[model samples]
Target: MTASRFLDVIVGVVRQHLPAGVSTRDLDGFMDRNRGLMESHIQRQLGGLLARLPGPGSASAEDPELPELWTAAKRTAANLAAMVVAAKLGAERRNPTAQERATLRGYSGWGGLSIEGAASKFPEGFPVPEARGLIHEYYTPSKVAAEIARAVRDLLPTLTGEEGVIHALEPSAGIGRMLSAFSGLGFEDLIWHAAEWSELSGRMLRALYPKLDLYQGPFERWIRERGPNWTGRLHLIVSNPPYGARGAAVAEDPDREYREKRAYAYFLRRALDLLAPSGLGVFLIPSGFLTARTGEMLTLREKVLRRHHLAAAFRLPSVKPGGREALFPGAMLVTDLLFFRARGGELPEVDTADRGILEGSYYREFPRHILGRELGQDAGDDDQTKKPRWGYQVEGEFSRLPRLVERPICAECRITPLLKELDPKLARNLRMGVMRTSLDLDGDALAPISPAPPRSGSAWTATWRSCRPARPRSPPSSGASCTRRCAPG
Candidate 1:
């Protein structure tokens, strides 16, 4: 039988004999018990086909056609195992029980490839393995990881004085995806270090990095106990840390306190502390880090934003798969390399004007390009500009975080000349309307009352009339008529 036919037969037999509601392990055990019979069937069918063609010693099996058949047979066998596992897992729901997970983990070794040897195995291609069993999560697509790595690599030379050996660290390295990209960038003798909390994942990383220095434990505990030793040593750090919120600890401990902070924030603070005087760091962080109002987020921003200048941020197109809702929208956050420099170190003088640094603006409007698009608006009134007359200026000419953080004020408050002509009560209502629609009050109001100040034109009368309560109106000629109209129904 051909490989497809052979697979069909095995699948048919499995479907016929598979126990109802059988656990994955039990199904695997059933297959194992029948292994001899299955192999015999496969070998007999393949042997007959080989006989019809040339023998291995003869020209038939040696023919290119025969080799393809042999390769297909191996592929089919692998696919058969995968299909069986998938079907069994689907039937069971949660990942197979611990025994099944362990069994699958061990069986994974049968079809594994070395990460370093990947390029050679598929000489004409990028060698990313197919998602298999539990190893799927560890695999970061090479194309995406390479793009992020290149962005970091471009910034690293500036931070490292153009020609120094750079020591990089990835806290949750998982199968070395980011590290592989780092190695490709020509860092001399890259001292790759990683930590894996999962026992199976740790084994996989060790296998991939035989000589690599690795620590296997919960990241927070590892950092609290061991991080100080590496302080002032690392030159670069990058990571795609875990996404789930840290759970309440079983016991009250300092390490639990460490984990209580979002892992990425903790890693960021740690990277800043560990970095060499002239080091650089890039992180893949949730976009919430930019606009978060929580105390932890505010504190994190206060510390990093003041010290580390924001170099670049790429708001990536959503690449997360479905069912992974907890994974926050990610952006590539690049911070200046100078943040790690020692006090009074010889540093390059940055032109505040040329670099586009100013109060109430961010660097996002600079000439920096991303994914082939220029950083900011082109010619027309782009979305970023144009603040509401009743609201604080939303978009400034420059791009910087510090410039944008401002408390909302009633537009009619007479503390400033700008606020003197506007109606504070009307502005407050408009602000409330903006908040109700989940829009920013700074500029993009959902229900804009008036295009400009009410005093600008006769159009303001219609706008004012629209906002008036639905109760009875007073006589038109008196100013009291306007006041009574403005009162809430």
Candidate 2:
């Protein structure tokens, strides 16, 4: 039977056998009556899908079970069961509690129907469910965790201080994966602080690490209310911040102030704000921060580079089309890791290169045991020279920062030597003298275009108040220098 059909059958059984006004609390009778019917079909579908999937090492483009497909199957069954229970709970006009919602949503379970390994002692473990919308909240895979741990190791030298303990914060601490990683690295006398949005996950994280000062709330509010007290005191910040648009719970005020709508950007801003003089932050966030082409993004980028010293950034592999499933599914956004120190004296030099542990010939060089446990394969020594690996192009103090103001192409740009043409008068006028004056348009200062000859036809097409230039051309010999500026009047 189809997966949806199977779910329908299970839901049908629950609806029919469920007694009138029966609360989800007392579903023992309902579960017992339909246990076989539900588990039979669910297990059959999940098991078949799992069996057909190839092992991780296989490069053959044969029928590979995509991670989304597996996630869909599990989510279908889990959501169907939850809907039925929700119906039962609502039959008595009662809303399910947060704990019930978590259970119903398959959060408190055996890590989303584990097919690779047998259920461990703790069934309700840290397997992040398929992401909900743009909120890409997947659990950090063990391989990625190891990679971050390696970055932390490199960062240890910078953490030298006379203090007896280092203060670290893991905002959005999902089930203590990062915390566990730090502990494994043997960080001595570390004072841990954790913040979580989910009450269920918060409770579980607190239980797991009783020493942590766990704060349960939206990170924005937590940062704002608790920020003043923490200024220049926090030592390190490490997290895989949630990626998505502003959440429903976040008030519009914070977003308006930042003028950026992404949740991760806000987390980054707060992280940089709450750092000690020599503090460090490591985040595995979306690739948009580097590649975004909006004014807001560019402004934020300028702010970050000016304020902080970016130590290293590694560009990890993202899910490609028609490829095997990556560790994070439903996370359509590309991922990268950012290691930067809080703003201090003169932006410290960066080491952005394609030579980190996750980059070049050294990426797949982990211990055989780690590879076996994490990637389900014995490590190979294949040449990775031709292979793509994750690494960052370190930005110098003024390197790679784009000009926010759109300067006219013919004015104040280095590409003037390339555009070989005859009109000496126009070239001299466009140089610096004539185009120096700024014309105010709508209270904003805009420079007038260089009255140069148009490529398409004679005489530039002029409007009442302004004129638009034809699309600029880049010579292939000059390394593809396309003009993003249009002279505004």
Q: Ten-residue segment with the worst summed lDDT in candidate 2?
A: 398-407
List the pairs of residues colliding in candidate 2. none
Q: How accurate is candidate 1 locally (lDDT)?
A: 0.39
Model 1 TM-score relative to the real fold: 0.41
> Whose TM-score is greatest here?
2
| Candidate 1, 123-174: lDDT as tens digits | 1221233334122232333334444553444344434422355666777775
List model 2 lDDT by residue over 1-489, tens digit each: 233323433443454355788854356456557756776777675757744542221111122332223465564455344444444453545556655544343422223344232323223433233324224346554345544653364345455434756778888787566776565323554677888886546654544445579898777777667654554556788988776666765663353545446777878876765665447888877655654445565556655654455555554544433344444554323455667765432111212321222122222332221111222121221111122223212111110111111111122111111111213344344334323433233212112244444232111111203323232121122122212122110
Give the runs in model 2 whose Cα sits over 4 Å from its true position: 1-135, 160-162, 252-259, 320-322, 330-332, 345-489
RMSD of each: 27.8, 24.4
Count of backbone collisions in candidate 1:
9
